[model samples]
Target: MSRLSLHRRLAFYGAAAILLALAAAAMGLTWLFGTHVERRAIAEMEVQLEQVLSGLTIAGGRLTADKLPMDPRYSRPYGGRYWQVQKGGETLRSRSLWDETLSIDGESAPSGDVRIYRQRGPGGTPVLGIERTVRLPATLRGGEAKLTVAMDASELTEARKAFALDLAPSLVLLAALLIGAQLAQQVYGLRPLKQIGRRVSDLRTGRASRMGADWPDEMRPLTNEIDALIEERAADIERARFRAGDLAHGLKTPLQALLGEANRLSEKGDEAAASAIESVADSMLTHVNRELARTRMAARQSGTQARANLAEVAGRVVAVVKRTPDGARLEWTVEAADDLVAVIDPADLAEAIGALAENAARYAEKAVRISARRAKSKLTIRVCDDGPGIPDEDLMRVLERGRRLDEGSVGEGLGLAIATDIAEAARGRLTLEPGKEGLCAVLELTAAGT
Candidate 1:
């Protein structure tokens, strides 16, 4: 599965919460409106019941309404409006009741107070009603009677449905606006993180040395820590380079003294002892040079705004190599464009390339070629020679320090190992492959402006 970004996660959760809240609001509004409609309906029924009670009279010893309620629905069958009166085994109902009646409990309510109820009405539909039991006027034959007026409960239900339908679009629009505002807030909040990322990239590429100040308050602690770490790392690398230089210089004098002793042994006619001492001194010198080179290369890698021209470095190495006896016997070709550049220190680039080119010139039978090209964000420098290349299995072993395939060679086997270390320090690599004629040494480096 793909990872979700911070913005996407925040948007998802925010939208969900907004929708839930709006849905709840919609439900609550619809319920409140339904309760309001029911209350108004019951209040209207109370007024109708009062009118029916006021119009009642005793004629011929029977109860009769001299006047009925004013609503026209009272005259229509099942029109959702109704009235009923009952006294001493007599019952009177509005025409809207038709042959049906409002179901009522046998227990009578308290006098002079109206009570609300819910029960099946005409045609088995539910209705909401108000009831009052009162004593008739003394002049109209004093007796108790129950009066009820009801309206169909379905009216309140329909009113609630209508209210929800009307509210849905507004609720949807509100949710959308809220969600949009939340997304904008999240983007604004996370902008600092993006800026920090770009600044860190600049630091790595040597465009900037430190994470500067004036960050948001929430991000100050983090930025300050990163700046401190970068400073400490640079200081540490500088100190290491100083120590390495001191160690190398201090050992050089002793190595020279050993060489002087070897020469004296040779003068004394002890050739084998002089040869052994010379070999040991040479080996120690080689190790010192290799470490010193590695330290400097690592310092360059830490952070340096240095750009080296590929063509220039290649030409310099070629000119130096051509002065050697083996290079004089071979043809050297340089095939790099002058504009091609890499993000590496000029001296470091020259040293790495010179090591490869010198090795190639030493072994080439006819010709040595130096070429470079930029591919995407990488700059590759290739040095090839027209000589017998090493076997595939021995390619990796040859890069190891002091591991020489041919011990008869004059120099210690540190050239290829030093070149490899330089490449690694610069976040690159060196690889050996079979060329069209013989061996190919490829140095891959980071291209400038990548």
Candidate 2:
């Protein structure tokens, strides 16, 4: 039922997008890093394999070597780097292999070509290596031999693990930074909207008649449209008021002529029929006036945004109503905040409160209490009496036009009904409930904010 805030929604979506992107980036970076580390290990092993092969030659149909790789790891058993050569079922291996043998799957590769693969090493650790076949010069017997250089694959795996460990914190930090930046962007991008809201509030409180300038290009059109709508609404209300006045005047002339005719009949010795005619004419007049008042209240409520001090209006109503015979006999207590203002026309509010105060004055046994205060978006004015309270079912009926709970009481029946219409026109309501000793009438209206 309420308009949701745009800033909060945008922030949520922006953060979600950043989080998903960071997640994808994290996964992609990890994949590329692992692939690179594995390839680098294989390339290094291939170079070592070439070095090991350079030192090998066939002599008397037996494999021989001039020198082995100088790396200290090769001389140490299970030192994590190894090389091996094989020819005609004869085998040669670096000292690093110790008693372990390199197991090749015999994947077919042309001579002088290199193949890369992985295998388990000492302690069942994973190993990455490159293997190649070379053609020996026919110096002894022309033959092909296989040479392989391998280092523990765990090294590359550990490097990738370490890289991920290091990158995780950085990516998390980057996500935080990006999210923070997104928050700032949201604030900056939406600041204009905040300004527009304040200006619109000013319009509602009667501080400004129209939206101000200096808006961003993106929002300027909206502000212009809102200003136009306010102006249009005002014009419509003005014309409505004018039409209502003309119609009420036109109807009042005929009703007054009818009442005059009844008086003439009464003067001519037809007392009973003339009295009935007068009563009917009076009832018709009440209806016309009630409808007219309601229409005028509506036009006034919508025609302008005006703030009225509740304390001042209450004081004025009390001053005028207490002069009556019924109100003068009873004590009156009024409580109102001096600075509290409501978004309603002063005359309209006065008329509404006057109705409640007059009603309380008529029924209160000993005293009447009137209080006004504002909370959040609403301003409440409550009038209570010390007389007998009305029944629950009669509460709503009493506010209907021309419906009186006590027919013997001397009064027009439009007080509560008109007050109810006035409250509704101002986008509020009137609730009649049982008070401690009597009926309480509460008129709630939209409060004005400075």
Put down candidate 2 lDDT per residue, 178-241, tens digits, no spaces. 9899889989998988888888777865667788568999898999998888878789878877
Task: For candidate 1, report its TM-score.
Answer: 0.75
**In candidate 1, how many Å is residue 434 off?**
6.3
User: What digit string (tens of lDDT, one per residue) describes model 1 on residues 1-450?
Assistant: 759988898899889999988988888888889888888888888888989999998788788988899999999988889999988788899999998777786666898888899888888898889999998889768888899999989988988998898888888889889998998899999899899999888777655668899799989999999988877777876787789879988998999999999999999999999999999998888788887887777666664446789999889888998999988899999999988988777878888998898888878899999999999988999999999888999999999987888788878888898899888877789999999989999999888777
- RMSD per model, one decimal: 4.8, 6.7
Q: Relative to the unseen true structure, what is the C-alpha lDDT of residue 240 in candidate 2, on a scale of 0 to 100?
A: 78
**Stretches of candidate 1 above 4 Å error?**
1-12, 57-63, 86-92, 98-113, 120-124, 132-146, 165-229, 263-272, 292-339, 345-347, 364-370, 384-400, 403-406, 432-440
Taken over the whole model, the C-alpha lDDT of each candidate is: 0.87, 0.84
True-vs-predicted CA distance for residue 63, candidate 1, Å: 4.6
Listed in order, each prediction's TM-score against the native is 0.75, 0.65
